[model samples]
Target: MPLLAADNLSLERGGRQLFRDLSFKVFPGQLVQIEGANGAGKTSLIRILAGLSRYGYEGRVSRSGAMLYLGHHSAVKALLTPRENLAWHVSGEADFSDRDIEHALARVGLYGYEDVPSHALSAGQHRRVNLARLYLSQSPLWILDEPYTAIDVTGVGELETLFAQHARAGGAVLLTSHQAMAVDYPVSRLDLTAGIAS
Candidate 1:
């Protein structure tokens, strides 16, 4: 069964129609990438699919299971440490233990900076702290918007590997990234420009 599906989605902003009659499905074990040029409504569509934007859009989005969504912003609090951020995530997806949070932070290359204030971290580091949620998430579906924005080359490679691993483990991922993905796994493309999913 598909983990998520969008039906007959249409959106208009500033008197411009971004897309119309757009539909797609993301099944388990599949990695889907949203492809489009700037101002093509990629982020807008992601927000719709992630249920972050409920108004001003004509669409029906359905999800069969839990999902983890990481948007364009890192969504980290500068006053909080990396450890605290994960422990008290605004999403309230799960109650993570100290060990679990620590392990996830280490996986994202924030091992020793776990307790450092986020304000002291670099932009990439802040993104790493947000990306750490991927390691800790048990959700079957992951929806990400521009996840590679502030990541380094090595970190990008790691994320690609992680996405592949998730697909192989019967999970699904839908993400938008300007950078081309370099991975062994097959990646399905949903080109908003053409309104095609293949």
Candidate 2:
């Protein structure tokens, strides 16, 4: 069975029909992209899928294992040092530890700044901290919104590598990004403007 399946989904906001008749399924090790212009309801769709909304969806979305949702805003605490922030997340439910945090940061070029407060870090650096969860999540499904924002070229490259590894390991991913992906992996896109992709 597919890891996740959504059938005839729909969502609305402020009485406006954000989207309708959406459907898709994700299998283990598959990478899916949700594409749409601004205001086309990509984020709303994710919110529905993540169960962040109490109601409004028209269809069922079933999944196995767990799913992690990462939004545009960094979940990092600005007042806390990078190590402290990362540790808290790890302890609070993330599947990584200090070593994993350090390794992830290093891979994203944030080495040597582990002890500094997130507020002291540049926007891009702060963004990197939020991304460290990608390595820490161990969840079978990742629902990320514009994860490439503020990340440098190398960081994006690392994300491509991460995606490859995750899919190979039978984890699934669903993401939305304006930029194109660099990996050779086959991606099935759901384009909202066209009213849900095939």
C-alpha TM-score for every candidate: 0.96, 0.92
lDDT of each: 0.91, 0.82
lDDT of 2 at 112: 98
What tens digits encode model 2's per-residue C-alpha lDDT throughout 1-198?
Answer: 787888988887788887887788888988888888899988788877777866667888888788888887788889998777767766766556568889867767778999998889988888887787677776888889889999878878889889878998999888988877888787778889898565
lDDT of 2 at 115: 93
Pick out the ten consecutive residues of candidate 1 with the lowest summed lDDT: 88-97
For all predictions, the C-alpha RMSD in Å is 1.4, 1.8
